[model samples]
Target: MEDSSEPFAILPADMFGQVTFIGGVSVEPLAAVGIIDEALTLVNDRLTEFAASPSFETDMQTVFGESVDVDLGRTIIDALSLGEGLPEITVVPAEKMNGIDGGFDSLTGGVYLADTSIAPNSVIGREPTQSPNLADVL
Candidate 1:
């Protein structure tokens, strides 16, 4: 006696009561929202910290000539895991820019040399992840 093709819908209050009280879930809507806001702040703090951190904390010398050819390609990696220190290095050639024209200085304009271990910083305040993580109640 029911329309078989019709979709089912529940009211917000009912859903909230059932999911939060009946189900005994840990997250309530407002609490979840607060947690999410805090997490976003944390992520922003982390990003700022990383950006402010030194690009190359240590200075190292790279050997090059007047006409140094550099390779440009994607390097392969394996076994990505957390807690590993990021790998980034700026390879400053031990050469001086004197006679070159219309080209970036190979010495002063030094190239960034990094291993693939570095992780990109997260963008701030974009995706709304709290909607799903939060409980129906609030």
Candidate 2:
């Protein structure tokens, strides 16, 4: 992501193994997975080090603020950490689509939702539209 002017698709959950963590940059169906795959490649290499680091236990203690098992804490961090250079999804500052006029993709989901938030009215559909909808089908 790395913060771009380009529009990103707020894809369906099923697009990513039941949990869509990444969004497509330009509505290319594969963009989300592509990004995820790349990200996994990057982070996958670090998992061993992160897990083996002795100080990682200290890092865990710092995070938990209690005497929890260092192994468990390291495991959690190793599991959750997405690694460096994580792409920006531009989720923030968005006013989630919540109007009747705004359209939705029936094939993907029944209703349109911005979740906690979504792209603002102005930034949406400015140039290259990656909107996930089939107007004729709807």
Candidate 3:
């Protein structure tokens, strides 16, 4: 028997994957190693596309009228309100330097702002968002 695996022996770990035969010919899906990762990417893309599309409230109304009662529809609506699934207007606060200062502006980002009355806050990433139809509390 011929050593068909010799061709892939030099390939890197990421390039290695399961081999199959098609019509008596060898075929290799190099990316098969990360099928789960690829699936996650596809799922994320699908979710983003769905989010960008129009709302499904109209469809619900078309079927059950504009008023949804206490049921699966209502629950779905509530869950859908978990933010617009879009990016929020983030106001990234400045970080303070590590030092010992007893200045009066210590409260407001270590005197970074002229207005010391302001509050000091910082976050690693953008803040969470809410439904666009709802108030802009965030």
Candidate 4:
């Protein structure tokens, strides 16, 4: 965020003074200042290409409402300090998945079943050749 004092300098002196006047019913100037400060902070943080666009003023005015003064957008642009244009972004392709033997099996979606043998200590025992009688068990 830029210095708080910097916004004061960008804002119109007469408008600021009006807001400071005692017993003044209107707070538009104060609200405008707050809007400008917030907008400046947002632009500085995001660094989006929109800040450099010519329609930035119209966009800001629309966001802050028609009642807001034009100076707000001007101040925000100055605070952004946008250069000639936004930098170009380059995307690198992702590395392909390497399956077993440094190759992928198109069939079965590359899944393979592991071989297993029964041991004496194994919890899963072999199935009985004959079907057990439920009556006898009961």
Instruction: Supply every candidate's count of residue pairs whose N, Cα or C atoms clash at under 3 angstroms.
Output: 0, 4, 0, 0
Using TM-score as the measure, the top candidate is: 2
- Tens digits of per-residue lDDT, candidate 3, 1-138, equal 242322231112222122221121122223322331232234344444543446655655677787755256545433434422212111111122133211233243211111111121211122565211101111
How does each model score on lDDT? 0.24, 0.39, 0.28, 0.31
Residue 110, model 3: lDDT of 19
Worst 10 residues of 4 by lDDT: 111-120
Compare the candidates by lDDT and give the number of the best one. Answer: 2
CA RMSD of all predictions: 23.7, 14.0, 22.6, 33.1
Residue pairs that clash (backbone atoms under 3 angstroms), model 2: 1-87, 1-88, 2-88, 96-118
Per-residue alpha-carbon lDDT of candidate 4 for residues 41-102, written as tens digits (9 for 90 to 100): 34444444565677866887788887776675555544535422211111111121122111
Q: For residues 1-138, could you state the per-residue lDDT of candidate 2 as single tens digits?
A: 543434444443222222132232223334434433443343445665767777776766787766879766566655545433222222221233343323345455433223222222222233345443211111
Please give the ranking of all candidate structures by lDDT, highest first, separated by commas.
2, 4, 3, 1
- In terms of lDDT, model 2 sits at 0.39
Deviating ranges (above 4 Å) for candidate 3 = 1-33, 59-138
TM-score: the better of candidates 1 and 3 = 1
Clashing pairs in 4: none
Q: Lowest summed-lDDT stretch of 10 residues in model 1?
A: 72-81
